[model samples]
Target: MCAVAAVLLASGASAQSGWGGGAFFNADVFRADREAWHEERLVVQRRFSAGAASLEGGTVSRNGFTDPFVATDLYARAGTRGYGNLRAQWAPEASGVPRLDLLAEAYAVVGTGWEASLGARHIVTASSAATLGTGSVAKYVGNWTVRARGVATLDETIAVSTSLSARYLFDGVGGLTAPFAEVTVGRGREPVVAAGGLEIRPSWVVNGRVQREVRSGFGVSASLGYIWDDSLTRWTGGLGVTGRF
Candidate 1:
């Protein structure tokens, strides 16, 4: 396989993956209860063979809800032993009431295409918390990918919720494209919402996504991303325009 083909194969055809240290921007818009809410997240990250460090900033605002707030997240991760990995994340308090949150998680890669993860969450301002931990599992079954995650919050106002999602990958559909669908059911305000989307990688180093969100209301989102690598040589720029990393 060529170098570019190797990268794409290692990526498992995921469009949102970055090769190494790079910058990525993502934005999300939500509509619920006849109100509009939006969030924009910017991330700068560095990834190595054994671990990674990432810093992310997010701004969220909604009508009739709390005022617009910005939050910072610091993350660090490392590989443990024999298919085990550890990760930690810190989100500083930025809400009006100011409650910091910390989460620690571990993941184990089982078999060839199965992964199990467990997480613990803590709210710095609350003496009371949730139960022991939350668990999730993800598996890739041939061209079909499956993921299910559940979270238990310590806050009394929020209920325990779990989300299930799946995607069917079309490796030979004229281009790199996949159709995905998700459904979430819980006791929350928007008890149930159904979403469907498509992730398309029309180019070797560029990709885009478009999705529709449905619940009590409806909305849509779109994003475009790009990535390139020149790590194979620093002086390739002087050689020619068609340089390879």
Candidate 2:
């Protein structure tokens, strides 16, 4: 939950990868974790025709929590008929062993507009326990694209959740302007979360969302968005930058 930004790495036939900077704000999450609840990150990522990998690290800070912590995460995705991803995070410790978490998932396209995935999340702590998770996603792409996803974990750590999203891309703008929105519901203790945002491309990059352009080679892009959940009445916004080189 440190960063769910660009959660879906590849969709359809195209892939997106580059170097970027990002920030995430978890409202009242400070109360839950007690330390390093808010994070700022610098990331380097690469996405090939059939696979993707990324490395990110930064400072996780929160008040009255554990000390300001330095954390790094590694993510990988690959496959053909289906795809798989591995995500790992580590919070370095000065004295003892590092605090770490790992998650891995495999997904495959089932039909014309459907993909199913199964995953597990592990907390490598003293007890070293793991949570089994499963999810399915469906997507339709054309003039307007739409997607829906549902996920649930065996353990309560990651509650059962579902989300529906849609977006319109401006063909006239070189597919640069995209307006999108998503609604998410959490089954257990977590509240429903929603977000509405726009992606605008200036130069060769998009400043609001993640989508590969019609034509690709190299470009610079930026993204900004606001999120709202039942738990936080106030809107929380985030910013990100990506450049291909």
Query: Per-prediction TM-score, please?
Result: 0.47, 0.59
Write down the RMSD of all candidates, one decimal each: 15.7, 9.7
**Model 2 ranges off by over 4 Å:** 2-13, 17-37, 66-79, 94-98, 124-130, 143-145, 156-159, 167-234
Judged by lDDT, which candidate is best?
2
Clashes of each: 0, 3
Strongest candidate by TM-score: 2
Tens digits of lDDT, candidate 2, 1-245: 44333334334423334443333333223123333234466655554444555566665443333323344344345555566767776764411222565677777777775666777665543333335465656564643445554545455355555555554433311111112333332222221211111111111111134433233332333334333433232323344433444
**Candidate 1 per-residue lDDT over residues 1-245, each given as its tens digit:** 00111111211333323322212223222222334334444434333344434444445433333322233232223343122223333333323212344555666656677767787654432122232245667676665556576665444444454555454454411011112322222221211111111111111122333333232122233444332222211110000011111
How far in Å is the alpha carbon of 148 misplaced in model 1?
1.8
lDDT of each: 0.34, 0.42
Q: In candidate 2, list every pair of residues with a backbone clash.
A: 34-65, 207-222, 207-223
Clashing pairs in 1: none
